[model samples]
Target: MFETLPNARRCAVLIAASLAAMGGAAPAFGQAAGQTAMPDSKAGAAKPKLWDARPASPNATINLVHLLVKQGVLTEDQAAGLIKQADDEAYIARQAAKAASTRADEAAKAANAAAAASEPKGTRHVTYVPEIVKRQLREDIKREVMAKAEQENWASPGKYPEWAQRIRFYGDIRGRYQGSFFPTGNDQFDALHFNAVNTGSPYDMASPYNLPTYNTTQNRNQIKLRARLGMEADLTSGFNAGIRIATGESNSPVSTNQTMGGGGSNFSKFGLWLDRGYLTYQAWDRNLVASVGRFDNPFWSPTDLVWHRDLGFDGFAVQGRYAVSDSFTPFGVLGAFPIFNTDFNAGTNLAQLDSKFASRDKWVFGGQVGFSSRFDSYRELRLAAAFYDFENVQGQASQPCYVQSSSDICNTDQTRPLFAQKGNTYMLLRNLQVGSWNNFGTTSLYQYYGLLQQFRPMTVSASLDLGDFHPYHIVLDGEFVWNTAFNRGLAAAGTGLPASVGITSPGVALNNRAASSDGKTVGPFNGGDKGWMARVTVGKKEIRQLGDWSVHAGYKYLESDATVDAFVDSDFGLGGTNLKGYFLGGSYGLSPNVWASLRWLSANNIGGVPYAVDVVLVDLNAKF
Candidate 1:
């Protein structure tokens, strides 16, 4: 049993044997062995020694059990039993410590399982990540969110309807300050108001004091506005439609300006007219187009010599173009436009109930052919020739008419022009017979005038663009017009001279070459029949971006019968033909879609009474 004992127990046994041989007293290990033995004198008896009742350490218990055997306090058999009991208690303590360690490991594993179960599905458990990877992930998330929001219109979901995607809207507005400076030596009375005389009651030829005339002497200043709104819709299959409305003082084909304080002031609402409404169809690979409605001019005119810029043709027009090569293109246009339509109930006289006038519907047939030649990418030239023929637009003399009272109607009253401006030769329409009423206080023949000569104008236009400086160009334009149907002999015969009832001067003739007041002997009618215009520009074609600019200068000379006075440029000579002028203008872009312009025009009458006008215009324009 001793050989099988551990080394620590063997050392304890050797130490106890050595202590007994030396006859040394046992050292007290703790309070259990510190008490000294005592004797009882009265009883003459020895008391038992006290011992600690707690469990002892393994080494201490072995030492204490050996000491008891040496001191005769316990027998050998009992000492051996105490030694075995100490060993057994130490073994039980070792088992308890191993059980506690096992329980702690199990508890840690259970906690780990619970944490994993509580996490969301598909979640990655990353304890550490790089800074660059984190940043890249954030950027990717942001881009994805923005793309989704845009696709779904998240800010205002479903706000835009499907049909709105196929429509496009456009408009522009302009405000102008204009000053008309008339020279001091203008003949105010000579410029007759032909429109007022023809539309209203006939002017009294006997009394010329109350005749309507133009304001040629008075200098006027006014503010004007022009606004247009338009939209285009795609009908698919190379078909499209458009409509536009604009501000106007009246329904005039040559202008859309509305005077700021006109039309019965007091903050009254101005009028809006249909400026354009058209439906067009394109075929043959978009080279052929046909339009039927009030639409823009189909002819490629270099300048507004024969047609006003704001005029729209109400009829059918077909335009065709063929691109022969990269450097050349040929185009042509053919259109027929109605000038005026006689009323269904022509005659309005109660005296002659069944006197209906003949149908005198006026029309114009025009054709143009043009070609564009591109010298290079930055240089081009365009040339065009056109012919416009007027049908049923001339006046005829009426047969002998008896106008004893105001209720009598002339047979050829409808022959007079529906509208006319200055600078056109005119002749009296009524041929009155001798009557007793003419000798009375009031004249019997109340008369109106009609255009003397017929009109069939031939025009040639050309434009050359030099674009050596990119985004800017130097443009040269020229146009010439000649009235082919002007006949001086016929014009002289149409004006009834001495046979007319009212003995009067030549009524509103374009030229002063006429001789007699009562139109007796026909004089040489030196009426002008040709007109030409030339212009030069150095600027961008359009003012779009900020800081863009352009400047232009031009000269115009239009004859009395070169083109219709009512359809010529309205700005020069205050809206008429038979005028020569020079104009200088410049425009600057203030911001995107906004611009400002200034122009000065100095014009004089080509023939007839002395008339001159200088106009200055300042304009602010905006578009969207």
Candidate 2:
């Protein structure tokens, strides 16, 4: 392979050299002729140390004897003698603790007996409630708990919890095939989604299914067999828990069905995945609720997948609902979460640093407030505001915000690559993993520059259901995230590029430079480099028990904020800046569990980086 090193000093060493550099850090027990030596920890009175799975080799223990001795589980003298005895037998000092413990237990027991024999004794009268009275009291308590829970469930989005259940499963499954106008990504051309009218319509025509390479009509046919499974339980009623698990395009905690990476580079990785696991408690039954865990960020969008959507964390959140009058119940929520997290994707990642929060990474905070109201006409309206604080991270270009990494640049070649990098093949290893979700990415890319430590964000949303508009809805969703720090190493501006549109990713050089140091926003004051979107869906009730069929259309203007971690490149050849487009599609009824739809998506002017794509997709889906 021919290549150019951007910085020779930064190049990675070959595996052999890397190993040799480890030297004493990794000792070989001793290799006999045509033989291999296995390294083992020392056995002694000392307890075994903590173990790390990486770089499996000899002498990887972190000495646990001192820890046990400090905890008073073993005495220092006993531990030392045990460790020394084992060291005499090939450095296995970890086994000696058992012997030392036997000696210590006998000594401690004898001492306790002496102390007890010399102590005093006292007595007190005791009385028990009658058995019949106790039984009646317990039954009464059980009835009161069940009655309290039932009261909460009577309300929508109610506050309810069961002591034995804290997690819920909710998700949609599609069973269908895809047929495309262009020759592309899949082989069958089409399958089935869960619900559809005929062969021409689809259920979720708004999804970015084919993504950058739309010409691949191979996924045209799909099925909606098992759409979703939902689980929501209150850890303790006032405190609630919820989660959704399934095998659809939506993101999961882990996918166990297939390698969610760009499914068809001829890859066969499938696995199960989870979405969100949240727990919260209300302070006064219906007044205030506090929650902690990975949960919805409060910025509403019909897009299904959301920006600033990392899914694991330790959190503290509070929400309140108050009724101003007989017809208005206003509600609001606020929360804060740390960056450290654990629920891993179904499959592993290519980079050792693919964790949501890199090691020792500092963290920022996030929160949102919202409200919804119902009117006499039976129509409901909602409004919400949110924020993210990407602390210590910023961007070099437009919106002049702070971004931890030049993420918009280093994206994998979802469309096509201009050059090859080692990271590319490393990605292949992760692609073979399973149960990954998300219609677009196998793994999300948060920081491109690798310098970011955390991200902070803000969002606002509005959705209205007009009663007289014939089962109609109007939604306006927007989010603006500022990297408290922006420091991607790249040219601040572009000098010789023509205008392009709808190119999801144009690489770092092009994507980063498009957002200029020059402040410019949408509609006003160079507006804000945030995200702006609007959509309206109007439909009638189910026709013949199939379901609602509605035609939907919307417009979106996305500035190069990079906070929304998911991005797709061009499928229609020329590629350049961020994403911008119009989605025109609708859904129709087939059977209660079957449906179909069609769509035509067009793109032109993107983040001042030139790129374009025109896509048309027809889908069918079914579920039981």
Predicted structure with the largest TM-score when compared to the true one: 1
The 10 consecutive residues of candidate 1 with the worst lDDT sum are 499-508
lDDT of 1 at 384: 96
| 358-426 per-residue lDDT for model 1 (tens digits) | 888889899999999999999999999999998877777677776766556687778788777667777
Model 2 ranges with Cα > 4 A deviation: 1-171, 176-227, 234-236, 242-244, 248-269, 297-316, 338-364, 392-457, 469-528, 540-545, 567-577, 591-597, 615-624
The alpha-carbon lDDT assigned to residue 308 of candidate 1 equals 88
lDDT of 1 at 427: 70
- Residues 232-348 of candidate 2 have per-residue lDDT tens digits of 875564766777555533332212122234344345443335656677677765578666766654334334213423233446667788877766767775656554232334113
lDDT of 1 at 550: 93
Per-candidate Cα lDDT values, in order, are 0.78, 0.40
| TM-score for candidate 2 | 0.45
